[model samples]
Structures are given as C-alpha cells and as structure tokens.
Target: MFSTREQKLLRYLMQTEKEMTGLELAGHLHITSRTIRSMIKNLTAILEEHGAEIIARHRKGYQLHIHDHSAFRSFLKIVAFERVNEQWIPSDPSDRIAFLIKRLLLSEDYIKLEMLADELYVSSSTVKNSLKEVRELLTKYELVVDSRPNYGLKVVGNELKMRFCIAEYVFNSAQKTTELVADPEMAAIRSIILKQTKRAGIQLSDIGLSNLVIHIAIACKRVLLHNYVSMLDEEIKNFEEQAEYLVSRQIVTDIEKSFNVTFPNSEVAYVTLHLLGTKMVSYRKASDALSPVNLVSEEILTLTANLIDQVENELQLGIHDDQELINGLGMHLKPAINRHYYGMNIRNPLLAEIKQKYPLAFDAGVVMSNALHDSLGVHINEDEIGYLALHIEAAMERKRLKPKTKRCVIVCATGVASSQLLYYKLKSAFESHLDIAGTMNLYELRNYPLESLDFIISTIPIYDDLSIPVVEVNTLLGNQDILHIEAYMVDHITLVLDYTDPELMYFQKDLQTREEVFDFFEAELTKLGRIPAGFKEAVIEREKVSPTCYGNLVAIPHPMRPLTKETFWSVLTLKKPIAWGDEMVQYICLLSVQKEYEDEMQKIYQFLVKVIETKALVDQLIKIERYADFEQVIKRMEEYGSR
Candidate 1:
C-alpha cells in the first residue's frame, strides 16, 4: 500500500489536468522539493505496474499518464477498500484537525501536544499549527481548548455543545455510518427511527434521517461513558407537552429494549428536540397552500410574507407571488426556527454548490435572512440560508419554464387606422413573444397604465422620460424596428458593457490582501466621488455574512446594501493570488449598484456569475495587461450570455 503522502499526491494529480512542478507539489504538501522528488520517484515505480506513470517534463512539471483504464480502475478500488479497512492516519492539515478533534473529544484527560505529534507522525510545531484551526472550529460550537501548565489541552464547553461537536467531527468523519459503529448496530438504529417516524406520520429528509441516526448513536455512546444531556425542569415540561415528545419516547423505548440500555428523561427530551428540528411537512393542498399548519404559527407566516415581499421588492425576481415558494419557505422556517431556538446546527452539504451555481437565488436568500433577522432577531446561518436559496431557485426555475411574454403598448401619432395596422404587424411578427396591452394615439398614451407595461413601441418619437423602455419604430414596422423590439422580448443582454467602466479597470495590481484591495478601491473611488463614506465597512459587513469568493480564482466584493448612486463594476486583477476568505482570488470585481437600479441587480449578477463559472475566462482576464483585452473578454462573455 502507498503511504498517506503518496496517496494524497496521487489524488491531487488526478483532480487537476495541468502538470504540477515539484515546487508547487512541495508547497501543497508542506514539504521540501527534494522530498517531493523522492516521493515522485517512488510513486512512479509503484504506478508503472498499476497502469499509471508520472512523466516529468524538463521545466514544466510532472503529469500523470494513465494508459490502462481497466487496470487503473481495479487498482483504485483495491486501494480505496484497503484504506477503508485499515486504520486511518492523518495525511494533511485538514485530516489532522479532524483527528485531533476526535482525540480531544474522546479523551477524558488532557493530552500533550508532543503525544499528538507522535500519533500524527509529525513534529510538535506542526501539531501546534493544526491546533489553531482546531481551536477555530471548536469555537463555532462554543467549545474552547483549555491549556494547563502540566496538563496539555482539553475541550471544555456545555455538555450539549460538546456532544454536537463530537457528532459532527467524530461520527461524521467517516464516509459510511457503519464505519463508525457496527454495521448491524447502525442498521438497527436506523430501522427503529424510520419505523417510529413512519408510524407517527412524521417526515424526515435523507440528510435529516442520517443526522437523527448519528445523534442517537452518539447519545448511546455518551450514555455508555456516563455522560447525559441536561435540561431545565421547565424545558423538559414544555417538551413533554409536544407531540414529538411522545414519538421520542416511543423511539427511546424501542432502542432501550434493543440495546439493553435505558435513556433518562433529559436524553428523551434531547431526542424530541432533534425530532422537532428535523420535522418536515408531508402534504399541502394547492388551494390553501399558504394556510398555516399546526407547527406554522401566525408569526412564521408573517415573517415568510415579509421575506417574500422583501425579495420581490428588492430583486423583482417575479417569485414573490409563487404560492409554492410561500408554502415551502413557511414550512421550512418552522423547524428552522426550532433548531435556532435550541442552538442546533443543521449541516447543509449543498451550500457550496448552491453558492456557486445559484448565486442570484443565494443572494435573495441572504436578503431573506436579513429580513428575518430584523423581524425575529434571529441570525440565520449559511447552512439555513442555503436551504432557503434552494426553494427560491426552484421558484426561479418555475418562472423560467413558463413563457415570458413581454407586455407593451403601441403608441402612434397617426389615426386609429395606422395605429391598428402597426399593432397587427407587431402581433403577426411576435404573437407568442409579445403581449400587446392596447393600441392608442399619442394623446391617449398619457392615460395608459405604464406600470403594467414592460416597454412602449411608438411610431412617433415620444421624448417624455418614462419608467419602462421605449422602442421607436416606423409606422410600417421595418425589419430594424422588429429587431429593436425583439431585443426587449428576448432574454438578450442590453449592453452589459454599460455596467463596466474603463477608468475603474485595474490590471496586474500588487495588492497582497483583502484589506489592501479594499483600501485601493476606496482611494480610487473616493477620488472619483463614486462611493459613499462607509462603502468599505458595508462591504466588510457583507463579507461577514458570507465570503464573496465563488471559486475559479474570482471574488466579487460589494456592500451589504446599495450605497452608490450609480451602478458600475470596479475590476482589479492581481499579479498573484491573495487569500479571500477560504479561497484564493486573483480577479476582483467590486460591485456598487444604485438603489434605483436594484431591479437590474439580477442581470448584473448573471454577468458576474459567468465570469466566476468560466475558468478559462478568469485565467485569460487575470493575465491581460490592457483594458482593451479585458473589454473584449467582457464582450465575449456578453455574447455568450445572449445565446
């Protein structure tokens, strides 16, 4: 079997298509270049028989060449199975953190750093550095790593918090639940939970089921260790009155019989909390979807309505009236609020993918969270925000699937006959795409309901400023006129380049940190009088909610709310990548949207999302030194988006 470092090197090579130099590998592995070379030599010898080999280029790097696909597949399966069967060891800093967390959580006495270092086969300094990240992780659970003069380190926190941390860091570290516990034991626990939930007519998602099973398994283990969850007398009384308490009791009774262990009332109440937190609504009729259920209170309904209103008013996503979204969000918030009240953290495995793919919806989710905080005084974490975004994204998809007919009113200075002729011509050309609200003369145009119209197709030029767009066309409605109106009807980019300014594009900058980037932006924008006084602070506050780094070497930093009077993007490309939150970014687009242009934010984000999702474009843009090249790339992005 390959060593942990060798296996990690192989996995890294398999992940990327580009060749990696020895220096780069050494940096990633936190080892010397000489050591990387030695490891590469040893790996090459082993992989030659396994249908893969490492080819070292003169100056470029080393690339993995896989020649025998069948042999490679069998070799990978054997390696994976062997790794799963054998005792796991820490290979990297992340793995070491998990290992240390599990060790600290399980050990009754304080463990020395030297002892951990020996277990990890690393130096004490390495263990100390890994502990910094461990401390950060533990802090999220209200856990602290206490150090004593003679004793080394121990995790100290609320019993409930410690159990929650242990459930995540220890039991969840393995890919399969059976790996953490005996296969039959896990199966029995899972079967009991499923049977009880089904009998109670309670619904649980796949992730919810897994979490419940893991927490129950952890409870059983902790009970064996003489540790039990404690609750206030009033809290237990309140829990007992709930329906889930009875269900929890039934589950505990069955498990006690199967495992030959008894659960205290506090443990039963703890299980009831999990049940309440993971509860899902199974059915809702479409006619009265928004009608409040037993769990959904009037306060939750009001908050849900406000959130939908805020999203619609701010983004104009056309999903505020979506009944399914209203129902889904209301149902989701009930259990979500329960989780928050109990200080339970629900893990969202799709948070990263949601942020990357559904950025606009995720931003809408952020808006909803802010509104929720204002109304309920509860801070919704990123995981809950991600789940909220899924519902919003689904609504967005539903809206997209429906035909988006553009509404317009035809205006002409000529008599009714000419206006009527022009209306029919437009209808004939775009019957399915355009919804002609009405035809009227120029004098009657003032009385028209402009709010309901998307644009005005006028035969004569109407110089009066209007809220919606105006497309001037001949009475005959020429081909060019048809194309002009088509731009409004189709989902085409209406000059996305208008949001980008040449003066704001900075290339190959020497900024080394996020603060430096903000400083440079502030100095330049302030000189041009483009930003408000507290623009940088607002952007930093938004970052605290969630980092703007969406991967592909790009980060789009913006204020929490609109603070600029004009909508525009300030682009910056660095000479080298800088740390932005957890990801490294070389391309930065500082966005400042005008409050009046909030409706256009979705379109603006779509353009930025394209830049984030396309790696080749980011790589090309970061390497360019001229604004002309950058402009061309943006233009290409616009062209691609229009299609």
Candidate 2:
C-alpha cells in the first residue's frame, strides 16, 4: 500500500526508539531535505488510515505515534503479505540498485535507461547514478556492465561469472531478503524440496530450505532460457559419485514432472552444487549416537578441530571440547569446502549483526579463517566467518553456564539468627549460581581462610584487605543488597568502552573513497608519531582479507594484527558518505593495538559493537562537530543502550 520511500521511512522509525530529525532521515535514506519532507507527508497520509500518525515537533524532528496498537499491528501484517501478493517496485537507492542489477542480469536484451527510469518513477539522472553503483557492485562478481550510446546497457561478462552474479544478487536476494515472492509458489516449492531432501536423509532449516528453493527456481528459469550452466567433464565425473548429486537428481526429477519441464544432467549438477552447500547431517537417535562420527567426513572433522584450536591459541575461548560446536562447525565446513572447490558464493544475512554484537567471537572467527585458508585453501569471507562465530558464541554461552557454582562465606556482626536470615536470603537470591560455604563473624574474619571462597559476603563493616572481593550487606538484606552480592557472583561481560580520546576524534571531515579516508588518517597519525611506518599497509592487508565496513554507515578498520606500540582508536566522521567495499560508510574508527598485549579486550570490543549496532547513535555522532559533543553523545548512548 505504501511506496518504497514510505516503507523505508516506516522501517527506520520502527527501528529507532528515540526521535529522529528530518536531517538524520535524509542522511540515512540518501534523499534531500525537501524530498524527505514530501515523503513524510505522503507516509503520514497512508499511516492515518491504520491508526498511526507521524508526530512532528519543533527541534525534535518526527516520530510515529499509534492511536490503536492492535490496528497498527494489523496494518503491519497486511503490508508484509501485500509485498508478496502485489507487484512491488523499489523506491530507495539501495533497493533500486538491487532491482537494476537483477533486471540487467536476467534481461536477454539491453534495457534502456529511459524505460528503467519510467518504471522506477525516478528521473533519468537518478537512473544514471544508480547504474554507476551497479557497475561497482558487479565488479565483485567479476561481471561488467556494457553501455552503448544509441542502444542502452547490458551486463556483460563470462557465462560462469554471469551465473555466479545471478546466484549472488538475484537468487540470494530472494532467500529471506526484502524481495517478495508469491507465497503459494514459494510454499509449494519448499514443500516439494523438503520431501525430496527428507527422503535423501539430508536436513535443512526452514531458511536453508527456502534458499534452496530459490536456487532451483533460478536454475529452472535460466534453463528454460537455454542459459544452462555446464561443468567440465572432470568436474561432472567427480560430482556423479556424490550422494548429494543423487539427491539433487531425485529433486529435479519430481520438479520436472510437476512443472512439466525436462532437466538435463548439467542442470541436475547445478542443483547438486546448491545441495552440497546446504545439506546437513540429520540428527540420530540416542542409541546410534556413538556412530555420529560417520555422519560427516573425517577430513571435515579434522579441519574443524584445527580451526577450534587456532581460535583457542588466539583467544583461549575454551570451546574446543564442545562436541556440539565441533559437530555444527564440521557440518557447516563440509559444504563450505565444496563451495570453495567450485568457487561458489554464499551469503549470510546476519553477518552485519554478528560482527556488531559479537566482535570477540568474530575476531576468533578470523583466526579460524586463517587456519582454514592454510589447510583447506578456502579464503573465508566475512559472511562465512559470521556463521562460524555463531557456533563459537553458542559454545561460549555453554561454557559460561556449565553447572559451576561459586563458593562464598558470609560474615555477620550480629546474632546467629540474623546471620541465618542473611544466609537464607543469599541462597534465595543466587539460587543455583552460588553455594554458601559457611557463616562467620567479623572477629572470625581475621582468621578466616578466604582463599577457598570466590568472594565474601559481609553483614558488618569489615575493612580488612583481602585477595577476594568483599561485598558488604545489611543485617537484613534488601533486593539491592542481594543484587550487589549477585554482581560479584555473576561475571559481567558488558563492555562500556572508554577508549575514544578527545585528541584522536575528528569531526565532519571531507573524505572521498575508502583509500582517501585511510590516507587522511595515516597522514595525521604519522605526523603525530602515533603509528609505525607500515601501519597503513597493515590496515590495507586486513582489508584484503575482508572489508571492515560492517554496515549501518559504520566501518571499524583495524590492522590484521597489532602494529602499534600502544592500543588506541582514531575516529573520523565524514561530512558525506562514500563507497567502502560494496557499502556506504561515514563513520570510521581505525583500531590499533600493541604487540603481545595480555589485557582482556572484551570490554573494548563491546563498546565498538555498541557503536556499530545503533543507527541513532551514529546519527548523533555524525552531527557532532566538537569532541565534547561527541563524548556527550557517546555517554548518552551508553546510558540508553544499558537500558
């Protein structure tokens, strides 16, 4: 029911809890101030019907206010399904870029820019700008856009490169992305694929199944157009013996009968390639659990172990013994290795969020990536690393919660009855996480052996210096007192980063490309003697491994390894956004660390993750022209994010 701009505006408003200014919205949507105002008026008109209205205030911008929550929710549901039922066209630059790429990729003939502009409801000049971005995106897939003056523009490249580009942009976009597909058609394909995969003893999650369905649908469409993908005789011979190939054949055979289309061996091979990327070992019964080792290959298992060991060597996460992690990583890596062998591309939608929230885990994933590169010769992209980080995160969670209780001694200055009451209160509060070692008086605290206990909970003022932390509580403890004791019992992983120096912060700097921004930072830092001679090269090398641009208009570029004598972060906010490895970035944080440092950096990483996670915070940081304002905004965000 809404235009593309309206949809994007609604989505942005929904994502932010605080009020957003028109200027902030304009920056994020890449539209002008006047265009933002016009779009907001249009959006408000549509939203009023659903009991929702955009509330505008002086100096505070606009926010969505709902008159009836139930009605607003119903409106959202309708919009979601409408996307599938109605013909949807992109209204924003990002979506339009994707649309243009898919259109150019699938079109048999050249498409005229005037026709594109007409269809998209944009000006000819806007279309031209979108095409430039399209050309940049195509370069990643090794594809090119060939433009002629009289005729128009068409995507031109190798047949294999074209297919890969289609697989990445067109098909992958359909897999749980914003692109809409007919529900009935999507559901039918998923059901058919599920039946075939189940019959073959291959397991896939719902999202994975949907992804496969899209791949098959693309393959079918391309085959009908006589745009078949063919592998060499050696590759085809090797694929014929694969179990996944047989499963793919069965799936294609049923699809052919239902869709009234015939698929050749090459098409079947193409389907098998997708299968190899997605198939997982089915869960076995407890009786057959001991034979689970036979599910995945020994090579993959060995590689998984090596990867875990590498992470352990780097971060010491202590997840190498987690069998579930080992199994999950092994299963994931099997298909990943297959993809590398054939140079296939896979996308992870959660990659950005994973990098933002789990920076330490992502760092460990980088270590695992290097190990995989050395052993399997497969270069790991950030998307694949995100999946690996998920497994590592799960293992860390398990390790943190493994039935281990803390031992503590409670010291009481009052009578035995009060001490007993405090003891019962502590037990009720901590539950399973704490074990009361014994109760002791303040006089007995001097002779008390505190080495065996994790921490001491005291009822009276005992100022004796001790190795273990001491929590002072009242004779009759309240909720706050219990919480205070629990704080010592629970190891807080929340990192409130306090590393942004006032001198290192640069505001509203005019920078162009990724290279230009890095160059500016290098020149500034080098002039101040803050970094080594090879610091810039170290940062560039890290980019070669993977771009540090983690989306949300933020990029935290750091060297592959520590290259500085001191650990510090140099931050710069650009006045205008620039292209940074397939994404637009404005806020840049150049991270540097001393070599062979032993400090725990979970807190610092958490802080950086917070910056990456919040769009409003980034908006606030961008508008700030002074270091004091920047620091104030960060402090405000820290307070808000904690809430």
Candidate 3:
C-alpha cells in the first residue's frame, strides 16, 4: 500500500497536466526536495505495474503518464476503497495542528505530548511545533492550552467559547458531522431543528440549519459530560423575553425526550442565541409590506446605505442604486450584529471561492467591512466579509445582465452619404457588439459629447489627443478595420498584458517573508520614482483589512485605495514559497491602479482572479525566469480569456 504522502503526491500529479518540479512538489507537500526524490523513486516502482509511469523530464520536472486507462481506473478505485476504510494520520503541519486541537478539545483530562506524537506517528518536537500553531488558533476563540509539567496539556476556556471552538475545529471537517458524532444522533438533532424552525416560521439557510444541529449535538455531548454553559441571571432573563427562546425551549424539550437527557435553562438560552444569530430574512421590495428592510432598524439601514455608498465611491461599480443589494445587505447586517453581540463566528464555506472568483466584489466587501468597523466597532472576519461579497456580487451580476454596449461615434472627413455608408457597414458587422451613437465630421467631434462615448472610430487620422480611445479605420471599413475596432471593444480583458512592465518583473528572488517582498518593492519603485513613499504603507493597511492572498501560490497585493497616476503590475516570483497569510505564495503581483481608472480596476481584478484560480497557469508563470517567456504565458492567458 502507498504511504499517505505518496498518495498525495500522486493525486497532485494526476490533477494537473503540466510538469511539476521536485522543489514545487516539495513546497506543496511541505517536505524536503530530497524526500520528494526518494518518494518519487519508490512511487515510480509501484505505479509502473498499475499502468502508470512517472515521467522525469530534463529541467522541466515530473509528470504522470497513464499507459492503460482501464488499469489506472481500477487502481484508483482500489485506492479510494482503501482510503474509506483506512485510518487517517496527520501528514502535514496543518493536519497535525487540527488533529491536536480536536484531540485536546474532546479530552476532559490533560493529554501528554508524547502520547500525541505517538498517535500522530511523528516526533515529540513536531507535535510541540504544531501545538504552537494550535495555541495561536485557540487564542482567536479565547481558548488556551494549559501546560502543566508532569501532568500534560489541557484546553482551558469558557464553556460557551469551548463549544464554539469545538463547532469550528472538530465538527467543521471534510468528513460529514455524522462521521464524528453518531449518524442517528445527528439525524435526530437535524430533524428537531428543521421541525422547530419550520413550525416557528423561522427560515434558516442550509448552512444555518447544519450549524444548529452541530451546536445542539455538541451541547448534548458536553452536558452528558457534566459540562454546561454558564450565563448571568440578567442575561438569561433578557433571553427568556425573546421569541427565539420559546422556540429553543420546544426544540430542546423534544431533543431531551428523544435522547433521554435533560438540558438546563441556560442551554436553551444558548440555543436561542444561535437561532437569533443565524436567522435568515427573505429580501423583498421596499414597497412590499413584508419587506425585510421594513423590519430592519434605522441604524442598520443607515449602516447598509453608508456601506453601499462607500463601496460605490471606492469601486465605482454603480451598485448603490440596487434595491435588492440594499435590502439583502440590510437584512444580513441585522443577524450579523446579533452574531457579533453574542460572540458567534458563523462559518462561510465559500470564503476561498468568493475571494478567488468574485475578487472585485470581495474588495467591495472589504470596503464595507472597514465601514462597519468604523461605525459599529465590530471587526468582521473573512467569512462574514465573504457573505457580504456574495450580496455585492449578486448586484454586480445583475448589472452585468444589462451590460453597457461599447458606444462609439464615427468621425468622417467626407460627405454625409459616405459617413452614412460607413455607419451602415460598421453596424452590419457588429450590430450586437457595438452601438454607433452617431456620425460626425472631425471638426464637429470637438463639440460632441465625448463623455458618453467609449471610443471614436475615425475615418481620417485625428492629430489631437483625446480622453477616449480613437480607432482610425479605412473609409471603406475593411475586415482588418473591423478587427481593430473589435480589439478596442475587448481591450479591458485583452490589454492586461500591457500593464505588466518588463522592468518591474523580478524572477527567482531569494525573498524570505512578506516583509522582504514589500521592502524590495518599496526600494525598487522608490528608486524608479514610480510610487510615493506612502505606497507601501497603504498596501500594508489594505492587507490588514484582509490579506490579498488568494491561494494557488499567488497573491495580488495593492493599496487600500488607488495611489498611482497610472495602472501597472510589479511582478515578483520567489525562489521558494513563503508563508502568506494562511496560505503559501511565491507569485506576488503588486497591483497599482490610478485614481481616475477605478472603474477599469474591475477588469484588472478579473484578470488577476483568472491567474489566482488557474493553478497550472500560476505554476507555469512562477517557474519562468525570462521576461520573454513570461510574455508568452501572459499572451496565452489573454488568448484563452478572449476565447
């Protein structure tokens, strides 16, 4: 049987078509290059008989080649079956940290470091290092690892925080909740939650329902262990007055009868807090009597309006007038404030995807987060920011549905008949794609409304520079002229390559940390007089709002707001991957956009999103050392995007 690392290595190789160097594979697996070499040699021997071979290329790296598809499929099936039955062991530092946390949380008594190391099949020192990360993670939940000499270590925190931490670390696993708790018990808890919420007319999202079930199941487990959440007399009194408290009591009573266990009044209040925190409000038009915004308080409405205005000011996305966004965000904020009041951390499973796919909207979410923090004094986590981004992204999508066509005015030096002929030809060629506002002479273009136009399609060469792009075409309007006009139409996505400065590109740099990368950018850009001294400071502030690390070994860092006179990218690729926020990153693209081009920044963000999402593209780009080769990759990306 293949070892866990070998299986992971093979899985990674199989997922991608591109070659992966030993260093790259090692970086991903969190192991030494020497270990990767040894593993590949052994894995090669095993895979050969299974109709697969590991191809080692000269300087390129290794790739997986399957000679017999049927045999490889059979082998994968066997591996899948084995994985289902096999006991999982912690293979990486992240895995070990999670394992240690789960073990410590579940255990009532102190657990020895040596016992943990033995269970994880790792050295005591490894467990100790992992515990440091575990301790850091626990601090977020106000929990700590109480280390007692000779006794070992135990998790120490408030019962409420302990359950929250448990819900996050233990129950929030790749494996289903039923895998951790008994399936029957989880099913019963879920059934009770669904029935009670439905009966109370309390609409809950699928995630909210699952969270309630997990928390109640955890409460049951802890209560059986003689651990109960503590609450002040005043707090319980206030909770009892809420409608959620009555619903919670009914749910808890039914659970008690089914499980043959009793819950204290404080436990019912605990359930009520979750109900209030995770409650969903259906959005409706403000004109409707049943609108959620009608139920929302003035404070929340004002806050939501301010957030929308702030995002619109920063992004110029024109979403401030979106009624659906206004209503949805107002409704989301009501529960969000309650969650903050109760110290609850609602999980957003789509946070990573949201960051990658809807990056512009996510940045808008960041702007909203900063506004909320300033107004409400609540620091919204990435998960909550992701939820906010969803609303903004929906608004963005709605805006996209009625996309603004490329508007152009024809400039003709000839007579009206020739101009009309040219306009008719252009319209016949690109009727759906372009909107010809009107035709005018070059002299009349001086007085025309240039602000409303995307570009000017001129028959004759215009000598003067203008605010909008001017595409000079033949009076006859040939196929090549049509293609040139088309290029201008799609320039936002295709012109991304132009933003990458060859002088700004740094490849295979020996940077050790995020600070080192920042310092390098500061020094280089400063020497070139490309940025102000405050540029790095602004970027750091942006990172503080939310780390720009979008996984896939890529990070696109930028100032919180536009600080440059022109938009451009300063690219940096490290010799080795460095810790970037919660992920590892080697490709850092320092994006600087001009203040006036904030509207066009969305296109740039979309381009960066494509780079972040395409693992193969990032891997290929990071490996490149030459500017010419980098240009080729970017050109390919542009071509692929155009398709």
Candidate 4:
C-alpha cells in the first residue's frame, strides 16, 4: 500500500500529460525537492508491483509509464478505499491549513500549537505557518483566529459569519459526499423543504434545493453549538408578510419536528432569506415578453440593463438583445443583492479555470460587476462575477451560432481507414463550431484547394510550406492537438492588428510590482498625450477587483472602462518574471480602447492569446533588448500563426 503522499503523487502524475520536474512537483505539493526524490523512489517500487513505473529524463524530469492500465487502476482503487477508511492526517502545507481550520472551527476549546504540531508530525514553526493560511481563509469569511498565551488559538466572529464559514468549508466536503442527502436527518429535511416549496407553488432548481439543504444543515450545526443567528425584529416583521416567509415557516416547523429541536423566529428568518433570494422560476420567456421590470424590482432591472449595455457597448459582443441573458442577469442580481446585504461569500471552485478558458466572458463579467457597483452601490465579489460570466458566455454562444461556421480539412498519411477515423474524430470534437470540408491522404493534398479552408489538421508532419495553418496531431487526437486546431478556428474572426507601435512596444524593462508597471505605462502614455488624466486610477480599480493575469506568464491590464479616445495596445516585456497576483508574468499588454469604435479588439485579443499560448514566443520576446528583436519574434509568431 502507498502512503497518502505517494498516492497523491501517482494521481497527479497520471493526470498530467507533460513531464514534470522535481522542483515543479515540489512547488505544487508544498514539499522540499529532497522529499519529492524520496517519495518518487518509494512510489516507483509500489508502482512496479502494478506494472507501472516512473520514467525520469535528464531535462524533462519524471513521467508515468504504465504497462497495464487496468492493474494500475486496481492499485489506485485499493489505495483510495484504504485512504477513506483511515483518518487523514495531512502532511502538506495546504492540506494542513485546511485540517487546522476544521479543527479550530469545530473545537469548543483552544487547540495548543504544540498539540497540533505533534499530531501533524511537524515542527511548531510549520504549524504556525499553516495557521497564517488558516487566518487568511477565515479573513475572507469575516472570521478571525484569536489566541491566548497558554490556551493557544480558536475561531471567533459574529454568529452569522461563523455559520457562513462553517457552511462553506465544513459542509463543502459533506456536500460532495453522499452524506448530504444520504444522511437520514438531511434527507428528511430535504424532502420536507421540497414538498413544502412545491406546495407553496415556489420553484426551486436542483442546485437551489441543494444549497437550501446545506444551509439547513449549517443552521442545525450552529443551533447545536448554541450559536444562533440574530436578525433585527423589524426586519423579521417585514419578512413575515412575504409568501416565502410563510413557506419557510412550514418547512422549519417540519424540520424542528423531525430533528427534535426547538424552532426560533431567527432561524425561520434565515430560511426565509434563502427563499426570497433563491430563483423562483425560469424567467426566460417572461423577460422576452414583458420587461424585466415586471419580474424583478425596477432598480435591479435597470442595473442589469445598464450592465449589459456597457458590456455590449465596449465589447460589441452582439448579445445585448439576448433575452435569456437579460432574464438570467435580472433573476441572478436580485439574489446577488441580497447576498451583498448579508456579507456572504459565494464560493466558486471553477474561478481559475473560468478565467483561463473564458477570458473574454470573464472580462465582460468584471465590467458588468463594475457597472453594478457604480449604479446601484452594490459590491459584487469574484464568485458572483463568475456566475454572471456563465450567463454572458451562454449569450455569446447564442450569438456565435448566428455567424458563419469555420471550415477545415483533415490530412492523414495512412490508408483511407485512418483518414476516415480522423475525419469523424474532428467532427465529434467540433461539430458545431467547425465544418469538416473533407479529408485527404498525404499525396492527394497536392490538388486540394486551400482557399476556403480555415485550417488543416494533419496526422502526419507536413514539410511543405502552406498558406493555411496545419496542426500536427496523432491519429487519435489528444487535447493539445484539439486546442491547437480550436485556436485557429476561434481566431478566424480576423487576424488584423492596428495597435502595435514600434515606439510603444517596450522590451526588457526591469519592473517588479503591478503598480510599477502601470505607473511606467501611464507616464509614457500621458507624456505622448495618448491618454487622459485618471487613466491609471481606472486601471488600478480594475486590478483591485481581480488581477488580469491570464496564466502563461501573461498579464493584460486594462482600465475598468474606456479611457482613451482611440483603441490601441501598449506592450511591455519584463526582464524577469514578477508576481502579478497569483501568477508570475513577464509579458504585459496594457489595453486602452476608445469609448466608441467597432474595432477588431477580439482579433487583437486572439493575437495576444496566441502570444500567451506559445511559450517560445514569450521567452524570446522577453529577452529582446531592441525593437528589431521584438519585431522579429512577432514576425516569427505571425509566420507560425499563419501556418
């Protein structure tokens, strides 16, 4: 049997397609390089027993080699089951931080630092460092870790915030487990809540129902801890008049009877708060026929319209008339406002992936949130912004389907069977966005016309220069190959660039913080009379909301709103990487768009994404000291981008 560390190592290796260095693995696992080496040695022996081995190369580090996939899978299952049965004692810093938080959150007594260190089998100093992360996590929930000289530490905060934190972290695990509906108490409460909501003619989506169950469990836990949520009497009186309040009362009455606990007015108010905010019904058709003002409050409707207006005005996403988007935002904003009023943090586990995959939609969401902030005096958090992005992305998709589809041709070196296989694979992967014009063998490519074809997906390497881009891939296409082809199809809108200036493109500037980089760009633009005053303030405000680092050592910093009279991109290449939020960046593109212009900014964004997706281009561009070198790299990038 493998240790927990070894199991985690194996799982990570199996999932990753690229070879990982010892240092990279160490950084991800939060352990020393020495520990990584020892663990791999131990992991190798255990893996060999299951016909798997860890492959090591001089430059590429380690890769997993599995001879019998079924054997390795069986080994993994055994390890996983064993892990579940055993009490998990975390060894990694991040895991220890989570473990420490659960301990402090659930414990009624102060946990001594020495005791924690001893239990985790770490030094007191390591435990202390982990506590710092715990405090940071708590700070987001408006909770705190209080310490005494001898008694050690415990969590302290308002009862509401404490319960919210508990619901977020402690119940987050249970929400994943069958424990949520599988537990007898929770299942009964879920049934009662569903039955009562249905009886009252209130609509609760599957996710909303799950959310309500989690809140109910949290309420039960808090009540058991004698930490009751308190609400103002006047507010409770106002809620008593609403239909949701009545429904909540019935549900709470049933819950109290089932759980054998006394029901308080405050507890009833808590459930009512959820009911009032939860999505009542699908407003897609209603919003289309009648204005959103009829379904939701006039103020929120106006706010939603203004947000959509600003985003469409800037991005020209062609989604302003999307009724579904309008309905989604209008419906979501009502609850979002309620969440803001209560200072609740909505957890988004997909935030990082959302930013990576849907960068354009994410920016639109940020703009929408800023519009909400300016108009309604409502603060929107990143998680809520992510939720908004989903709606915006859906609207974008609807808009996309209206446009002409991109067409591509597939090339296979082998027999007709292989070509047919590759052709079908491409169709399955991109049936909606792409049109598979045809497939051809290597020799038949000579007569094939490339004028109308968007790009080429070739199973074999093509040595000949071609006008259209050709993505080399295996007969059984992989993810990276798909991404390569998709990149071309996506950027097919237009590859034109009118913003790059030799004078504005600075190369290899030694800068550190985000502020320093912004200050330098703002000063240069201001000196050239290219930007107005307070442009930096707008950029800073946007950065404060969410850092613009989009992975791949790239950061595209732009103002919260259009500040320049003309759309242009100002480029900066750092001599070395600097921390831009959580991601390290050496490539910076400062974007300043005009207030009104149907420009090809999306194409320019595609160009930037091209630069981001290719590390060779970024590395070469970063090392450039002259304009010629920078231009040369861009030329090479364009050449590679073209074919």
User: Cα lDDT of model 3 overall?
Assistant: 0.85
TM-score, prediction 4: 0.71
lDDT of candidate 4?
Answer: 0.77
lDDT of 1 by residue, 1-643 (tens): 5577888789888988889977567545545567788889888988999899999998999999999989999999988886776455665566678778888998878998888988888899999999999999999899999999878999988889988897787766653434346867878999999998888767788888988988888888778778889889998999999888988999999999999888999999999988888877533332444344643666777788899999877667888788788878987898888888888888898987788788888888988999989988888898999999999999989988887788999888888899889988998998778999888877788877899988999888888878878999999889999888888886534355677778899999998799999999999999999998999999999889999877777788888877788888889998767778777778898988787655556777777777777777877888899888887877777677667
State residue 198's C-alpha deviation in candidate 1, in Å. Answer: 2.6
Q: Candidate 2, after superposition: displacement of residue 615 in Å?
A: 5.9
Model 1 pairs whose backbones collide: none
Q: Any residue pairs clashing in model 4, and if so which?
A: none
How does each model score on TM-score?
0.83, 0.72, 0.85, 0.71
Q: Against the true structure, what is every candidate's RMSD?
A: 5.0, 6.9, 4.4, 11.5
> What are the clashing pairs of model 3?
none
What digit string (tens of lDDT, one per residue) describes model 4 on residues 1-643?
A: 5455666787789889889988567545534467789999988877899979999999889999989999988987876665665455666555677668777887778989999898888899999888888899899878899999999988998877887787677767521433223477788878998888777656665666767887887787678667788889998898887667888899989988887877689889888887765654422332254444546677766778889999988788878888788877888888778778877656666787677667778889998887887877888888888888888988987876785578878888787888898887888987777888888877777788888787778888898888878888898778888887777765532344457577788887888777899889988989888889999999998889988887767788998888788888888987656778877777788888788855367667667767767666666766778777766666667666568
lDDT of 3 by residue, 1-643 (tens): 6666788899999999999988789767755577799989988998898999999998999999999999999988988875675356756556668778888998999988899988889899988888889999999889999999998999999999999999998888654434356978899899988888777667787887888888889999999889999999899999999878988999999999998899999999999999888877632332457655455667777789899998877778988999888888887887888888888988999998898788888988998988888888988888999999999999988987874679999999888999999999998988777899899888889998799999999989998879889999998989899889988876556567767678999999998899999999999999988898799999999998788988788888999887888888899998878878877788899999777755666777878888888878988988899999988887788878777
Model 2 misplaced regions, further than 4 Å:
1-7, 10-20, 26-97, 110-136, 139-161, 172-188, 282-291, 403-484, 491-533, 543-555, 563-599, 607-643
Off by over 4 Å in 1: 1-9, 12-61, 65-82, 86-88, 108-114, 144-156, 174-179, 282-295, 407-422, 437-488, 641-643
Give the alpha-carbon lDDT of every model: 0.83, 0.77, 0.85, 0.77
Ranking, TM-score, top scorer first: 3, 1, 2, 4
Q: Report the poorest 10 consecutive residues by lDDT, candidate 1.
A: 282-291
When 3 and 4 are scored with lDDT, the better candidate is: 3
